[model samples]
Structures are given as C-alpha cells and as structure tokens.
Target: MRYIHTIKPLGNRRLLAGSCMLILLPLFFLCFTQTARAGKDPNILFNGCQVLFQGEKPYIDQNNCTQVPADFAADYLGAVISQDTSQKTISITKGDTGIILWTEEKKALVNGREVSPDSGAVNRNGTVMVPLRLVCETLGSGVEWVAETKTIRVTLDNGYILPESTCLSIIAPPPGNPDKIGLSILLFLDRDLDKQYDDIHFIMTGIFDTIQADEIVKHIGQKKTPKDNLPYRKWVRDDRAVTAGSEPGDSSISIIIWETGG
Candidate 1:
C-alpha cells in the first residue's frame, strides 16, 4: 500500500499509545452500503475508518471533488449544520470555529474569513453536498485519498490511521517443536507516544469504540486455552504486561507474544 504522511503545525498534535485489535473483530458487524466506483460513486471514511451512510451515498461531482450529505459533518465530526433555504446558505459551527457556505458557491467563510473550497457546494436530490476536503479542513481535520484502495482516510490532527504500523514482522517456532511453541508479532510506528505517561491507558477505538485499559488487562488475564489431547498447557502466555510504558523516543514498536508451551 502507498502511504503518505503529511504533518503541519496543528496546535501541537499529541500521540497516545493503544491497541487496535478491537477494530479487527467488529468488521463483521459493520454494514457497507456500497463501494466507490469511478466518479459516479464514492465512499466516505471518517477518521481513517469507513462511515456507514444512512441515505444518499457520497459521490464525485462534475468538479471532480467528492461530496457528501449535509448532515455527514455533523454526525461524524460533531459539527452543527444549519441551512437558510430563502438565502440559499449553510452555516456550520464547532467549538470556536464557524464556517458559512452558499448553495452553489465556490467560496466559504471560515471564522469570518473567506476561503475558496476545492469545489463549491451544490444541492443534489435535496441534499446539500460539499467538497470533502473543504469540510474536513474547516473542521480541523486532514483528508488523504488512497487511490490504490479508492478509500479516503480523514484523521483529526493527522492522528494515526489503520494498518497502524508501516513495518511488521512475525516470528514463530517451527512446527512440531517438542520443547516449546511460541509466536511473536512486532508492530512498529514512525512516531512515539507523546510524553510517555507512566500510567498510560490503552483505549482502542475504531472497529469498536474506546475500550478501557483495565478491560484489556482483564481480558488477557482470563484467556484460557481450549481443552485438547495435547500435553501442552491449554492457555498461551507472554512476557508482556498488559500495562506497559514506552521508552523516550520518536519511534515506537510493540511486540505482542503468544506461546503455548515451554
């Protein structure tokens, strides 16, 4: 996969350490409405995750810019949207930031400053669709298009995205090892956990919502191997403490180990 990292001074972006294994299990539960095909169809991703559109799916307009339903920003980014039918204008507000756009206009007012969107706002099928990049940028988020997958990853403050690590390696014992059986997967990222909090909490949000650090520890502790005829212990064990801290640095790697017997 071709991945690009874009960083800007977005008011001190902070990194937090956590496991995203929860994201893998819940993929079965999500409902995919459709896929992005050519320019007629488009899929919207929120915070590097696919969004489940309720009504009209997103589409690319004549301007070659992706447009989404008016309420999409409100639902995903917590932005409040309001429209004036008589004036053909729309307004959005999040925290101290305010954005104003006109129906079929190419310029938007960001916090009282006029800015041109990659594409103007247009009303389609009674739904006001605006440029995807415009909405995200106005809301303090970054949008990246992955042409290989036809997917867009919109991250807040350029936060970490899925396939979390750029480099991954797995090591396992050869099959039929009489003395021991073990496996280890190392996931590495290009950045470090900001400040390295001592009591760092692991909150996995994505496929699943934010999970508490304590819950993860308990889940690992309760894991039991299935009963079988094999002489090895039922459960696998690893040296990792459910709660661990990162070293002081900009790069980080997490090694997760699973073992059956020794």
Candidate 2:
C-alpha cells in the first residue's frame, strides 16, 4: 500500500525570516573576518625578493612599519643588538654606527645623540621589535617601502671598502658566543701576504662613521706614539663589535688578535 502526506506551511512568515537571518548572520561574519585577515599580509623583501627568517617572521606594526626580530638584524644584517629590560631600551651597533631606542619612544639615540624616527621600537611577545627602516638604514642598508604590495625592500649597502694597503679592523667583544668576552681586534689586510704580518704596532682611535676608517688611521698616525687609547671601553663592552667591510673573503690574511686590555 502507498501513502501520501500533505506538506505543512509556515503560518508566521516573520518567524521563518528571523530564523534565516540568524543562520545567515553567522556566515556573513565568518566571511568578513577571514577576508580581513587575508588582506593583511606583512612581507619583508630583501632587495626585491623575500628572505625568510629562521624562527620569527617580521610583522607590520600599528604604525604600518615593518618590525623584525632582533636576531634578524644581528644574524643577517651584521648588527649587534642588546636589550636592557629595566630601562626598556634596545641598543644596536653596526660598524661605527650605534643607536639606542626606548620602547614606545619616538626618539632614538644615534651615536649618543637623540633624533626622532618615524616609528619607535616596540615590545611584542617578549621579543623587542625594532623599526625596520630606521635600524636597517642605520646599519648601512637601503630600504624602500612599497605600499601597494605591503613590502619592505632592504638592500644591504655593501660595507665600506678599505684602501689597497689598508686593513679592515674590528675591536670589540666576541659575538654569537659568550665564553670569550674581553677586548679583541680582528685585522684583515686588504692585500695578501706570503706570511703573517708580525709586530704590527697600531694606535687605536674611535670614529663616528665607517667611511672615516682611513681618516682615523691617518689621524692616529700623526700622533707620535700616543698612549693606549681605548675610547669605547667606557661604554658597555657587551657582545658589541665594530666592523667595516663590504663583503667577506675580499681580503687576505684575516688575523684575530686578542688583547687583555688590563
């Protein structure tokens, strides 16, 4: 036997419309949330291509500036970063350039002088995030911001090149390791020698710019056997090293000499 049943119709159209609205509202909200997140892409480009960070990826802060991990500048940009939680400050050193930033402060200390930047350093997720453009530029890198694609193009300015007979020297604390933490100078002779240069006596003088490396040497040369000058010792001797080089392997006979600096 076959049975036929009559379909029941809604008496109140408003109730049926209300039920539909409840279901559709949630779906609309989900779509809107997903689209908002998809539109926000923070990408950092080295030169013109994307460079991946080992652990943390750089993000765009509220100021719409790229903020990268502290280690990224240290490892890739050859910058030395130090943090003092008590002071809420972050210090970065590269070559003869040094900058100190306070969290949420718009001003930065460029080589001990205060200057305001577009964006300041911020603390996020226990990691200090620095303004990418200001820090990278201070580290001798050129940065271009593409607003249409939300990209930060960083072209690391090939470091200063030394004269043919000159040596690229670095004097500071050891980086990437902590066991050795005294004063040391690594001198890279621009020209190769059959053997190491022995008894290389040189006086130390500090300069504000890497381009002044040769000038500093000339200035010190004029000094007739100047007293042991360690101008940077008064500053924090932490894992901060000064360097001046465009690229590695361009020089021969790289010698690292350790000094007790007693």
Candidate 3:
C-alpha cells in the first residue's frame, strides 16, 4: 500500500525574504539603468539672468528694448530683464532663442560630453532656448526633444531638486563690533499657504565691524535713528542696496549687508 505523505510549503519569514528580493532585484536594475542614462542627461539650475544693451543699461524702457539675457533664446528660456519696479516676472517670450544667464556650478553631461555655462541668455517669446547640447551637458539634465510634443524633457540629476524662487534680503548689524548678536529676517509672500518658504526677503540687524561701516552706509544709507539710538539700521534706496528678481506671478526684493561698523 502507498503511504500518503504531507509536506510543509514554506515559512512566513522565508516567503517574506523571497518577496523582498524580488522587489529589490528590479530596483537594483532600475538604478543601474538610470546611472547609465545619467551620462546622457545633465542637470541645470538657474542662478540669475539679465539683459544688456549697447548703453550698458541692463533693462531699459518699460516695453521696447534690445538684447535680452536668458537661459535659452529658443524653446525653454527665462529672461532677467526686470519687467517692473517690483521685479517679479522677467520678460519671457515664446519661440525666442540664444539668451544668457548664470547657473549653479556643477559638471553636466550634454550629448555624451561634459559642459558648463559661466552665464547664458534667453531670447524673446519667453522660450528658454539654450545651446541645448551645452546647457544639458552642464546641468546633467538628459536633453531630449520629442517632435510629437514639441517639448524638451530635461531630466535633472538624481537627488537634485528645483529651488524655490525666493528673494534674499539682508540687513547688516550696527557699526563697530563684529561679535554682537545680529538679526537676520526673511520675508516671503505666502502664496500656497503651505509655509514652505516660497519667496524670501532678508533683513539683518546687529553691530557692524568698523571697517565695513562705510561700505554698508553707502549702499543701504544711514540709520534713521542716531548711531547710539539706532533701531536696526535702516535701508536706503540705492542701486547697490536693493536687488530685484522675478518669480512666476510674484516679485522679490533683497537687502544685503555692506558692513557692521557705523
């Protein structure tokens, strides 16, 4: 007579381990693929953009102007020319190309070769068109164009995230005394209400080192109150004191500290 035999299938721990391996194996392969493809795409960041003309005026007239600096003159481009006193949106044109703008420092792969852009400019029509090959190489954002979509997909470097477009405003400390406690204030327009710090405005207040006093005063102006009675050094409207930039729909203002001493 044949005897009936019973066999145990598998333990939960063994099954779990096998399942984990199954999930991890594909993830490993995916990571390898991404690394290999990383060589093809480069990541790029926008530091700053501006327009320059023969007269040396960066942005002239509210409307008509000559020569704009942006990321790309065609396709994808962002302009630095301040559209208004608030300096919210840099003039962006669609279908323009070859603009110049500054970018963060890093090596990127473009068309299989590495490249960098000390600065670049954009064109009219607001299309940020750059030397596709160069910008892609420097930013390490895989540069690929799809005719069907008429779009450029820039795959950023792994672990890289776009910075929140925010303004940096700094208020310097009082004159003389570098070691004194200072105040650095940041103000941003809460658009999303998420409180993630979308836009930034900085105001720094404290004692200033004697050597830096003159330069600080020159840029931001003298304190509204007396040197001894000054309530945090006041900010003046000087070319150097205030810097403006653009955001999607909002504006930004920055106040930088020049010195510590009065």
Candidate 4:
C-alpha cells in the first residue's frame, strides 16, 4: 500500500463558523507509541498526520474525497482538520479488516457489531486490508499503530506545543531611533490566537546578557487562524550582537518591550 496526494484549500465554512466562536474548541485525543518489527512497518500519527506504512491498507476516497491508491508510496507527515464537514468514510481493509465505509448518509459500527464490507479479508500488497485500529477509531482520532518498531500515534484536539521556556525577550524602538539606545532586538510567540499582529523573527545579538539571559522560543504552529491575530514582534538592535533566525521547526518565541523614555 502506497499513497501520497496533495491538495490545499478546503476549510472555510464561514471561517470555521466564525473561528468556532472565538476559539477553545479542541478535544480529540489519540496516543500510540509502539514498535518492534514482524508486525510489519506501521507508524501513524493523526491530527498532525503522520502515516508511514508496510503491507498497507488505509483508504479514504469516497469518490474523490481523497486518500486512496493514489500512487501509494506514502509519507504525508502532516495533516490536521478534525471536523470540516464530516461526511464519514474510514477504511483499513484486510486481516482484522476494519470497515466503516458508510456512504448512504453515514452510519457504520464495529464494537457495536454491523459488519458487511464483504466480510473477513486480508491481502497485503494485493490490496484488501484494515487495522490501524480501524482507521483511528473511525476518524474520531485515537489510534496507535505499532508493529515491532513501527510507530503510529494519532492524537488530535487542536494539538499544540509552545514550550521553549515560554519565549519572550523583546526590546523595540528602531524604525527611527529616538535616542539611539534602544537595544535588545527581538524574540516572540503568540501562536495563532488572532489578536491582530504577527512577527516571527529578527534578532542579531550584542548580549544584553543574552537578552536578559534567555527566554524566547515558542510553538503551536498549526491550529489554523486567520481573521486577524498572531502578533508578537519586538526586535530592534543597532549593534550589540543580535542574530536570530526562525521558520525551520522549533518556533514559538515572544519578546515585546515597548515602553521607554521615563
């Protein structure tokens, strides 16, 4: 089984229903961490999708909905979109071949018993498979696929990670230099909470004692926010050793100090 198809731009149900009434709507959890081998290559992470395969069967293409034998040779490493419409159609055919292939308006069960997707089938490489804990519990999110060293963990609910000692080491005032003593540079992080303002990096360093001895590194990269809010930029150094750079993983920095001349 191998699959890799890319398509972007499909999430704007009135801006996610007005940003789900001003945020705080995240409750989907799935944690899977196992690996050994012999069970075959299996490693998947959801809601931040990471599905690596072997003897594969993980379908989802209810007539172009996407994710089925699309030149399968997989490695998506990214995906997050819990409820954008919920038409429902999860699959993993073969050996414990789980099936919730509901198309007539959605409704398929497993532990509740109601199987009839051609019943009991297992065929790796020749297609026909299932299991990855039944397509992450039928796409609700919470599936761990580990086959003796193969790891797959799908945990979603607006997943987040903004802990670099809670970054924030700012010191602005450089657009025109009021006293030429405005140092410190920048380092910030607000990570998608839309408040109107955005700045990710710009620092060079002159050692304001390592900009007051560290504290500027953040994360929380994908929750999708764009109505206006994600601001945190305060870096203005006119020489003293400041050379910062970001946008390559490990981001979530916040440092804004604008209140001088007292």
Best by lDDT: 1
Question: Which residue runs does candidate 4 get wrong by more than 4 Å?
Answer: 1-45, 48-50, 55-109, 118-121, 125-128, 131-134, 137-139, 142-262
Point out where model 3 deviates above 4 Å. Answer: 1-130, 139-190, 193-262
Q: Worst ten-residue run, lDDT, model 4?
A: 15-24
lDDT values of the candidates? Answer: 0.46, 0.45, 0.25, 0.29
User: Can you list the residue pairs that collide in candidate 2?
Assistant: 159-246
The sequence of per-residue lDDT tens digits that candidate 1 reaches over residues 1-262 is 3222221111221112222111112221122223444366654555333565655667776566777776666645545677777988777665556667788877776666666565667787777776677776656565676676777666554222223222222223322234332323222343222211111222222112234443433333232222211121122224212222223341333333333333
Candidate 4 on 1-262: residue-level lDDT in tens? Answer: 2221232232321111111111111121121223232333343443222433433434422221112221121112111222212543333221122333343332334433454332122333544333333343333334444455454444421122212121222222222233433333223233332321222222212223344323232232331323323343334333422223344333333233322433
User: Which residue runs does candidate 2 get wrong by more than 4 Å?
Assistant: 1-39, 159-262
What digit string (tens of lDDT, one per residue) describes model 2 on residues 127-157? 6777777776666566665556655566545
The TM-score that candidate 2 achieves is 0.45
RMSD of each: 18.1, 24.0, 24.8, 19.2
Window of ten residues with lowest summed lDDT in model 1: 7-16
lDDT at 141 for candidate 4?
37
State every prediction's TM-score relative to the real structure.
0.50, 0.45, 0.20, 0.20
Name the better of 2 and 3 by lDDT.
2
Per-residue alpha-carbon lDDT of candidate 3 for residues 159-237, written as tens digits (9 for 90 to 100): 2123232222222222222433132322233222122122221111122233333443333232221221212334433
TM-score of 4: 0.20
Order the candidates by lDDT, highest first.
1, 2, 4, 3
Candidate 1, superposed: residue stretches over 4 Å from native: 1-38, 158-201, 204-212, 215-262
Better of 1 and 2 by lDDT: 1
